[model samples]
Target: MNTLGVTLVLGLLLGVWAQTNIERPQCDSPEAEEAALVAQDYLNAEHTQGYKFALNRIEDIKIYTKPDGDKTYKLEVELLETDCHVLDPTPLVNCTVRPKMMTAVEGDCDVVLKRVGGVLTVTAFKCKTEESTEDICLGCSTLLPLNDTTALDFVHKSLASFNNFNENVTYAVFEVGRMSSQVVSGGLVYLAEYVVVEANCTEDPCVPLNDAMAARGICTAKGSSIAHSVNCQMFLTMMPVIDANVVDVNSTVAVTNSTSAVAPALPPMVHVHTGSLSPKLGLRYHKLTTLHNPELSGLLSAESTESDEVVPVAPGVANSTAPADAGSDSSNSAEVPVVVKKRDVPIVPVVPAPAVVDPIAVVPVCPGRKRFF
Candidate 1:
């Protein structure tokens, strides 16, 4: 082929390669996604009882992407309650300004960003009454006291802890897989995207709230970090679905209502023994070996013989019963003698037993059996 033909073929191949490599951006900017998340958060904030008047107003949308690096955008949101509300302005709610971070999900092409509220609460309505019921409750304290940076830090720490889990355990695998896949990598990424979008959704401040159900804080204990709080609220709560076999009325009530009642007083104590009881102590147990066990009862009639009883000797006393010195009287028999002889008894030598060694007996060699190595 001619040189010009070769060059044309090479040029065509290069163009195809370039076209395949090109990666079109999914959204106009990462900031747009963050705006959406802030908006959703604001809507959720309105549903909480005291913070019913809280609303989010997007102040600015800024997109930043490092050249050939992950794209990030910041959504500056203003969170405030209207004149009708009386909730204290916390760092999370009733505050005038808040910011949420958003990043593009690495692979997904859709411009839509997914978000998860760091703060979450669930409540159940009981006949739409003003009275409180556990059925309609607020929860998800895992999200409390955390902002963008702290939330991300917590997520990273969780991922690290999962990575350290042992692979041999079945439960560890399940835990690690669930956290790393669902919550850590996938859920967190999507959540960050949602935060960005929600933060930019609207410019209206203090979105009106008709009536709210409850308010709550979400606090999660991540690895090595102290529990953090995320302020949130909810309009409805979901009840846990329990199986019939798993629900035990009596036992479960005891566990759930530990603080329900005060305990009764204990009975008074009585002293029985007057003299030294010695606690009837030691490992020597008195056995009732016969039908009428007299040994167990220490009590006896006044005429009972005490002659055969042995008395314990005091420390450092000579106990020999040999006849006392010639001048000693009968009363001196009860006293220990200090003039006892101190004799050194001769030591008996221990003879060494003979060591039995095995006899070296020679066996008769078989004819023609030996061979040279």
Candidate 2:
């Protein structure tokens, strides 16, 4: 062979050897190292939530070089969570958070991450709204047998909107029946804690949710007649001035029950239907009439006056005594006979005669007519 041919063959062999060495390092180098570090940090963070995400696999390395001799590599990797599992019962009100950690760079080595197994997402509240509030301590005195299942849910019932401050909270209260030896017709003794629900009125400030009013009726089962109720349930209707703790400082809800034999009975106003009128009864007078006399009736009518002399009693009338003066002597007066006419049966309250008294006895004991004080 010629000297030139031998030289050309050696140069080609040297070029191929250099290409193989450069490609070997490109498959695994600095960029892959940095990605591995990031994956490690992510796994460490996942461990805090009781899960461990470890790198499963990596592949597909491709290297490219520019005129400036700058090289880049592309790759893929897979990962999986090692230990923890989460179960979610409700999806709407719950959220799922998953660990996300992966990075890519242009350099000698490239790392690709592929997720091997599915992640078990733990469910939690992303947002919760405040609904209502109640002040049960004031009116609730005794506990009653409560059917816990009867309680209504705020969201499902649409009773009231929850405020932003009352999210992700669980609260409850108990009701007891009053104990008494007396056999009351209805079970009257009962106590309950008042719960308050505020309306999320950002849209309609004046009104509350449709279920707000009906909600309490369901809670206490007392619609309009707390008077007959052995138990009462009430919900706060006012928009209370909330404190830093999201509780009302001065606002309260009033609870009432009728069958209670407790110290504090239902207020009198609650019994207004019973027709209690002592306060106004004193202002009225009893009406009286006597044989409907035309003359006496005339005096009560629009025309007669005291100056008009009273007529004498009729001849057949048994009570013919003369009309006495305003202050007359009655001991010397003779009694008059009264005759009562009977009805198909008999009449009642036969009008009594006006009683007369001696004027001198009632007057202060003045000295003899001639004497001076």
Candidate 3:
């Protein structure tokens, strides 16, 4: 064989040996933990809706060191749903995992992180959640995740059709609890069970439901493109003129077609007493913790009300109300007294400017990362 041919073969064998000998990092290592935490934070920040998630466990970790001193880490992380919603702004440390009785949701994510110059950043991540199997029928209907786009579309269309059929009250979709799909001869049939809150107006462009209102109902819809049907039972809260306890007025609306019906009497204004609201409403009113930067907290608290007024003082002198030349011995050695004038200005608290954060840098997906969804 020629010398060139032997050299090429030797180089190929060395490359294969190096590739096979790559080391896998421990899942509990510091680098792996840091990458997982970064990926979790990115997911929480990017997920604008639904409940927030907390890291349950790290499944796998792989680290690849580059020739330029950079390292890429791929992590498979499992996350559990927390009681706090995404809009609560509560720190993950304070959030508790939802119990299984409450239909807890869990997800697995494939995250890729790259460290350059000792700084780690998440490049790409994708998560898939397990669908609920409670009451799922075999070969009849398939349950889908609550975040599925197609199920959500079906929910919106069903709600719109419901509002059009019922002329008594305009209901808006508050939350979609469960959904399932079935294959029929005509087309696909979608079934959605959702909660609806009473909207302020009674038309297509009605105002959104008020947070303080306790009037809500449950609805179940089943249909396809050919036809749809919705049945809703709403409980309206009513405050009696003499009774102390609130009363619930029940109303039912059933529609099998999209045809409009006669308008019924509007329900009275709902007056819910304190501590009697629904659990879902209580979740919406959770007290959010204020998150402040530790480095800027002192500056923010030390802000002076007289920021616009500047009082220049001498380098080694204390503030005083005495005359500028009161303690003068010689004409050249006069003591200057800094007078602080008191004004009757109202002290207004100043709001601190929002801190600017650098955007996360993203790079191409690493070859070591594989999605397991």
Candidate 4:
């Protein structure tokens, strides 16, 4: 090995670890005023138990970024609780009451609101008087469950593209980041960070040396459902604004379990001429077809007849093959020559619903009523 070459390769591998964690330095307050405006919007428009709360004062504000480089803010604030009631004597009109204000002075209870990009929303909140830590502090509360969601299914089940993809694919490594939601079309679209570390190819039963060298895959998902996913690269370019689930953002990649597999692992970000490659996820970006090439055949055939290594497949769907050009969105009119076959996998479970945010607009108490005074 070239001494200079070896030294340079070592530098490349360590560069990725340089990415920032949300804990390093915390902001004393919100960075942009827009965050507060967004916060206020959350409260004035927030309706609970037939009561709408008005923003009183902001208790505290902190800002941080997610692993995917998107910024979000945490705001602790007070709200004035108000409820509407039918006046006993008046049939056509209703009167609003501030019960929390009637007899006793209402001490502010802390409610945290998150503002990311232009979509402002709320998550489950509890006030904490204790000085906050990176993982437990109220500042990090919005980012709770710092662990990856376990055994979740990939949003997209089928792979269609110019890249001849292998059915029953397995990943050497898989990971997802914190969950975040955005407003799109008429509903909230939730997303998470996604990455695939090592993978197999369509042409060769095992990943090839060069393709695995370039075996980049970061796919994510969209839709109100957990059962759908799209490739990140393809999703970014083709999917509409509402988000067909970010393609690579939350990709559904299956992991490889067989040890007799011949596929070479994709090299780590930092190159080491070591005997084996240490696979890392969420680094490179390989196209759907890059993992695929139409030229190779008999890729799925395993050399060892004694052992069984399972490939990942969408639940309840038949295993099948398609052309690289047939990628994700061929017109329904196009003729797909392959027969879809069923391979029984575990059924997909229902994903928890996306958290609710304050309404974008407030509805009126009466047909024409806008204010109390």
Candidate 5:
């Protein structure tokens, strides 16, 4: 081939065309996607109790994407209250700022996609024309989002706190995901993205909700962090779902209240034991044992014979009974001498032994290795 032909072949190889290859789509700028998110968040903010007000024109949108993938956008939007009952806000069709007229009004809006609690949350900064000072929109709060940055020193102080089971937990940058100047709550509540850096997993199936939340692959502690708070086995017979803090009346209350008129009060109530007494129709349970049994009253009082008393005879003491003197007076004929060793006397009250309910009548004999002895 000629030099010109060689050049042509090289050109075709370098120039990948539409027919020879798949069409390459232009990579979307981070700013453009963030603008859409901002507009959607604006609609959500306009949502009221019964109906959600929507906006079509999100005007003059300016999107800013940070290094951490957080996004912020500012625009002007025109509110349009619709009949739709959708709880979530759909994206605006267009963001065109038209000249102000009687029916149409414009408001400045700040929309942001913030990382919060390991989730991305959309937030908007907007102020009503009535609330704003002149043309400048100060959003909802005068404090501004800069208040969150003020807490940075407090956040650094949290490093001293020992967190996690192994004490290997760390403090990370709690970036503000969403900040609202005005909301249902009067003051500003910064919904922040907590950078909880979980410990690195050295092995598979690592412990859940420990330093390795990544092991569980979830932030919630339903099954991961918390085990059963109450006895699972006791309630497992009837209770199906295990929701935290929710009371299941069927499993807990209906256990002892089959035909009872009202649900019995839960006990044993704290600090309520008054040691009260009852008699007659009022039933009471005495801790009945062999020692306290009413049926075995007769056997407890059986006179203690000399052998029944377990007195240890001391080597120092000598007990002797003298035979009647043959020639002495009748009253002085017999004399008994008792020698008692005196030490620190331990006063002991005599208690009779309660009779056994049933004596072992027969013993089972295990003659060989085949028997369970």
Candidate 6:
């Protein structure tokens, strides 16, 4: 073939390749809307802790046709927080968007989807929320609206921790008045200022005091998965003053002096036991067992037995009861005492017992013997 004929064939192949691989901007159509909906569903499912998001609008869409006749959709979509929480079984279409006055959250997502055998599948996605963007720009601390889902969650967690430590009264959260959050190296920290009222019921769905003079208190809580602290103060009326001294001069030179005394007392304050209770304290027990460490299991069991008492275990100190050798003979295994110590106690090293392991049974075989079943 001549060089001209070869050049013509190469140009034709290049055109076909470009048409197959090149992405084309597409107008808003049903296909684009369908892709956006699918992406929205994916986002809502991935987010399990916060309020569910509904598709606000499709920002942009690009379609690419592959050589195998498959199509790829690259989309940018806006999402708005809905009134329903993620845990709620309500569908995103049925959920209504939360208003801005209620601290509504909005997010934008870049989603990539591909159609294989006429089925749409999300290939990749990236999202950025308005709150997160602001947080990153502002750095560290950020103010949160009381009605925000995350803020409310922190408020509830603080109240729960407070109730767990409180001995006399079981209080219920009356209102989440104010909240702020900080991003730390360990986790997010929430500072919540709220009001609590004495509750008639003890557990969840608690009934607040119904009396006209029901006791109310103001509480401030700073908490995270890493640590928790709270302080609550109750209001009280001032006592009446008492006159203790009086002096009177007789006759025309009559002079009088009086002295009044009032009790100097501050309102009662409730301070929670910090660092003892966690938002996920209840779940830690299962995790400790899942670690499969006998020392941890023993420690947990001991802690449960003395749950009423606070025992500080030194960090970086291995348990004295842990087995020295994990793979050892079962017959030689022996029980060891678990030593619990206070924070200031000196570290002590103790020899540990060998771990128990089951022996495998071996099947006996005769040489040159053939068997059929």
- TM-score of model number 2: 0.17
What is candidate 5's TM-score against the reference?
A: 0.20
Q: What would the per-residue lDDT of candidate 2 be over residues 199-283, giving only the tens digit for each residue?
A: 3233422222345233221122221112212121232322222111112212222222212222221111100011211133221
Backbone clash pairs in model 2 (N, Cα, C under 3 Å; residues 3+ apart or in different chains), count: 28
Local accuracy of candidate 4 as per-residue lDDT tens digits, 289-319: 1111112111121221112432433421211
- Among these predictions, the greatest lDDT belongs to 3
Could you tell me every candidate's TM-score relative to the true structure? 0.15, 0.17, 0.40, 0.22, 0.20, 0.37
lDDT string, candidate 1, 1-373, tens digits: 6999878865654333222211222222343434434443443343332222222333332222323332322222223322212233333343332111111001000011112242222110000001112232232112211123443454333222211121211010000000111134313221110000001102222111222322212111222222211111111221211111111112121111123233222112111111211233221111111111122111111111222442333322211111111211212222113211101122433522223211111121211111110
**Better by TM-score, candidate 5 or 1:** 5
- Minimal lDDT window, size 10, model 5: 216-225
| Per-residue lDDT of candidate 3, residues 213-309 (tens digit) | 5456656777752356666655342121111110111233343432444535443222221232224331321111112222211111111111233
How much is the lDDT of residue 273 in candidate 6?
20
lDDT of each: 0.22, 0.24, 0.49, 0.29, 0.25, 0.48
RMSD of each: 43.4, 53.8, 25.9, 31.6, 46.2, 28.7
Any runs in candidate 1 off by more than 4 Å, and if so which?
Answer: 1-36, 39-49, 52-56, 82-373
Question: Which stretches in model 3 have alpha-carbon errors above 4 Å?
Answer: 1-23, 132-205, 208-247, 250-373
Q: Arrange candidates by lDDT, highest first: which order? A: 3, 6, 4, 5, 2, 1
lDDT for position 52 in model 6: 71
Instruction: Report the Cα lDDT for residue 340, model 1.
Output: 15
Q: Could you tell me which residue pairs clash in candidate 3?
A: none
Pick out the ten consecutive residues of candidate 2 with the lowest summed lDDT: 123-132
**Model 6: runs farther than 4 Å from truth?**
1-17, 21-27, 132-373
lDDT string for model 6 (287-307, tens) is: 011112222222222211212
| Best-first order by TM-score | 3, 6, 4, 5, 2, 1
